[model samples]
Target: MSLRRLLRTDAAALIAAHRASVALHRSWVTPCLDQAGFEAWFSRTLAEDYLSLIALERGSGAVVGVFNASQISRGNFLSAYLGYYACVPYAGRGLMREALPQAIAYLFGEIGLHRIEANIQPGNAASIALARGAGFRLEGFSPRYLRIDGVWQDHERWALLADEAGF
Candidate 1:
């Protein structure tokens, strides 16, 4: 697998991946997001200067996973937040393990960010594990950080510094 910047031509493939990811996340979150909302979100993401990478199957060009760093700032305290999801079939395949570091390098090295953080639902063990695998350190929990499945949910905060990320 290889990680690359998302291109305009990838819109449809990304849409498909978003649909799969949303469906999978629906079981765990509230006020599930719809395709229209996803489209708007994706469009806005693509327009950002922050990095957005996609894990593609080299041979088939299939987008198996998507990860992004948004809200980047380059002042003395440079920082950016991360978000990611993988297609159901790609889950547990260690694809994120490979893609995340690459994306981190771009964010911290090329993009000159000093810190990166991931916010995950408290019970989302899979995501928590992924953040740990990517060298993120658990920080603290936030109450009602996000609205999910129609209810406010608490989330755990995880962060990694540029040097600590080993990128």
Candidate 2:
């Protein structure tokens, strides 16, 4: 698989991937399923401290998933919050497990970020495992930390520092 910055031309493929993976991402994330939402999301990525990257299958160039790094703070903070989800055909293949660290390396090495954080819902085992396997430590928990699927959800905070990533 290959990972790269999301492009405007990828709208159709990305929306199709999101539409196909609705069941898999039900309780975890709600990616843009239409052109309007995709446009808004794409707009957000154009902001100063937010970025979105798309992962693709090498041969077919099919979108495997998307990773977003947002709320980046520079200066002494040097950190960002991460969000990601895998598409239907690619969900259980260990592909995200491989690509996440590469994304982190880019954030740390190329973007000069010192920390990256992932907030996961308590009941999502797959997401938790992905975060853990990527070297994120269990930092803490927050009640009603985020609203997902129209309800307030609790979350476990996980983080990885640049030094801890063994760059």
Provide C-alpha RMSD values for all models, in order.
Answer: 2.7, 0.8
Q: Write one digit per residue (lDDT tens) for candidate 1, span 58-154.
A: 7888877877777876678799888877776788888877777878888888878889989998788888998998889999999988776668888
TM-score of 1: 0.85
Residue 119, model 1, lDDT:
90
Residue 163, candidate 1: C-alpha displacement in angstroms: 1.1
Best by TM-score: 2
Q: Which stretches of candidate 2 lie over 4 Å from their true place?
A: none
Worst 10 residues of 1 by lDDT: 27-36
The TM-score of candidate 2 is 0.97
In lDDT terms, how accurate is model 2? 0.92
lDDT agreement of model 1 with the native: 0.76
Off by over 4 Å in 1: 27-39, 46-50
Against the reference, the lDDT scores of all candidates come to: 0.76, 0.92
Clashes of each: 6, 0
After superposing all C-alphas onto the true structure, candidate 2 shows an RMSD in angstroms of 0.8
